[model samples]
Target: MGCCTGRCTLIFLCTLQLLTSLERQIFDFLGYQWAPILGNFLHIIIIILGLFGTIQYRSKYIVVYSIWTALWVAWNVFIICFYLEVGGLSKDTDYMTFNISMHRSWWREHGPGCVRREVPPPTTRGLEDHAYISVTGCMVEFQYLEVMHSSLQILLALVGFVYACYVISVFTEEEDSFDFIGGLDSYTYHHSPQKTSHVQLKPVYLSK
Candidate 1:
């Protein structure tokens, strides 16, 4: 399959980031959680700026976007490190497994209580149990997926920062070469010997 255009890819990623940031901001606000409030707000702003810069293709805005993205990479590193230090990977795995088991056990105990009265107990029992297991499995899968998504975002941001730097280098090189060529032309024109059009008239003498 052919790869998507860079502009399209950037727009897609920025849209995802914008949605993620907005969701986090809303959740935190509803929960009365202020610790990450500023961070989420800043992320929203930066993502919007990046989206605008990508669409506009302006060098100044793109340069700012690149710098912000680099900072975002650093922030992700800090977040990952904090998570690791607070709860190691093994601990996180165990926590997710624990949650899955708890959900499964809860469903096993309470599933019958929530079943519809019209459905026969025997026929619905097996189906209900299977549904609970499927739900638990999905929960476990999504827990790991979140972690993978965060890592992938960090990698993408780093790649974007590098690409922006390369673009800046290409622009800088072109400008420098143009100036160098112009300087050489100017120097050659100014320093080269100038031709004089004045010719000495010599008096013609009659040859003997």
Candidate 2:
């Protein structure tokens, strides 16, 4: 059979279906609203291609062919961008930093940047030159949820890489088989024409 054809092709199809369904379930469990939008769209695409391969295209070669094509495309997307984790602001805050000890009026009156801007370190006199105040850091805005969501994409990308390797190995095996046959054909066709008829009928007599 051709690359990833027959049983291999069927295995790949089943795996894809299972993976897609599992992803949907996981997304739903996480209460991922965008899951339906993104996951469902990709799921539909895979179903259409798989359906075409299994029903319209009788050749398992074509089924695997479509899968390889899809895999490579997904691999590219994954390699290029999917794995990278990025951060973004979740919401805007009134001040860059907040100090619980300080009153809101004090912040508004002094101007908001860092709280230290309003309450600078005392350089002069009895405030204690050696006393250290534990200062809380800035109230930076970030989407913790987005960071978590991106982890799943990174995982899927890794899986896609493995799938690409599997498909590539299957394709290479078929290519090697074809190359071997082609080499045999090339050697015999040119060098053994006088014996070609004998060789052609040799198999029949051998089977007897």
Once fitted onto the true fold, the runs of candidate 1 whose alpha carbons sit more than 4 angstroms away are 1-5, 86-149, 166-208
RMSD per prediction, one decimal? 11.6, 16.4
Top lDDT model: 1
lDDT, candidate 1, 1-208, per-residue tens: 1112555566677787777667656644553334345666786787788778667654566678688887777766655554444545432332322333322112222232233223243346554543322222232333233344457658767766765665555545666898999999998887653422122344568999
What lDDT is obtained when candidate 1 is compared to the true structure? 0.56
Residue 203 accuracy (lDDT) in model 2: 55
lDDT of 1 at 159: 67
